[model samples]
Target: MNEEKMLKVEKIRRGTVIDHIPVGRAFKVLKILRISTDPGVTVSVAIHVKSKKMGLKDVVKIEDRILDSSELNKIALIAEGGTITIVEDYSVIKKFVVKLPDIITGILKCSNARCVSNMESAIKPSFTLLSKNPLSIKCHYCEREMETDEIMDSIL
Candidate 1:
């Protein structure tokens, strides 16, 4: 076994491992999870690593934190094919691929400034998944369509 060929990310005793993030999106994932702001949490990030399945990918290992459904939903929007792994006692427990929901609410703000969700605090932003390949979404209120870049900016 060649040491240079091996990918050696240290294992976490208990936490979450987000793998297969699209290249250059690991920072975005970190920002979304606010991992950097929490000084006490231990985090390891590998960017643009060679991967057989994704060609090139990013990985994030966060110590002492398990993602909730809302956090997973947010991750799914950015990392469509990424997988989440749960670790406990230095052992793999649960693993699954991220899946976008049909209808997402409050997680993303509509790009349209005049949209009712933005105009009225009482109304939560709502959007329906338009397409996954190109990553498009339609705002339920303004009926405006947002593509990948727009969606990335609109995350609340």
Candidate 2:
């Protein structure tokens, strides 16, 4: 008798998993999170995977490290409409819905070519969610223009 093994998603013992990230943004999220091949913690990321909501999305699996609110907030903007899950003992301990902040602060820089934040450290970058109409965000510093996803690239 021969039986094929079924493929199923495994549960992480203890870690934080950020899912529902927009497709093609997983690697960018990794960069923004400053995640590296650190020996101390394990970081796993998958991009362009099929998702019910996104139809294509990114997933970040982290082990042995828990992120704080600030970090999650930044990720929320990058992975807009994503969900953050804290797992322990293979069970979901907490589920948080990542939402678009009405006003983004100090997390992203202006895309304006001449924005002072680009040249001088004296200026810090910030933005306000102007309209969900086109998912556009306005830079508080230089009044630059960008969409939710564009902000991720600007920060990088």
Candidate 3:
């Protein structure tokens, strides 16, 4: 055996890989994952890699964590059309598609201040995607049109 052959490569024993995330949201995913708050959980991230849908993107590797549907929904929002691969012993066991929710409610904060959600806490916020045609949605609480770009940059 040579010195090079002596090198060991670490691999995931079991975990989820959230890939194709938009360039800046990798850390946001981490925050949402709350890995730092939990022990026995591991996470790794890579940002601004070459991608087809996203010219640049980030990836998060989570270990020993099973994300629930609601958290998955939040991931879908920030990843903005990504893929999730669940790996066991370095082999892919499951694959999931990330899609923008048809109805996004209370997940995203309306940027339009005049938008009612911004004004009233009593009213839960909601938005319905008007079209996958151009990635646009209508704020249900405010009756304002919000595009994906706007949603991405919103205060939410």
Best by TM-score: 1
Find the 10 residues in a row with the least total lDDT in model 3.
Answer: 1-10
TM-score of each: 0.92, 0.78, 0.69
Tens digit of lDDT per residue, candidate 1, span 26-120? Answer: 99999888887899899988898888788889988899999999999999999998999999998889999999999998788999988878888
Model 2 lDDT per residue over 30-135, tens place: 7877887567878877777766566787788888777787788788777767888898888889989888689877777788879777888876677888775457
Per-residue lDDT, model 2, residue 59, is: 81
Candidate 2 has its poorest 10 consecutive residues by lDDT at 1-10
Question: Which is superior by TM-score, 1 or 3?
Answer: 1
lDDT of 2 at 18: 86
How well does candidate 1 score on lDDT at residue 44?
88
lDDT of 3 by residue, 41-139 (tens): 877776776665667878788887767776787787667577887788778788888887889876678878887688878987788878764567788
Pick the lDDT winner: 1
| Candidate 3 colliding pairs | none
Q: Per-residue error at 137 for model 2, in Å?
A: 1.1
Ranking by lDDT: 1, 2, 3
Higher-TM-score candidate of 1 and 2: 1
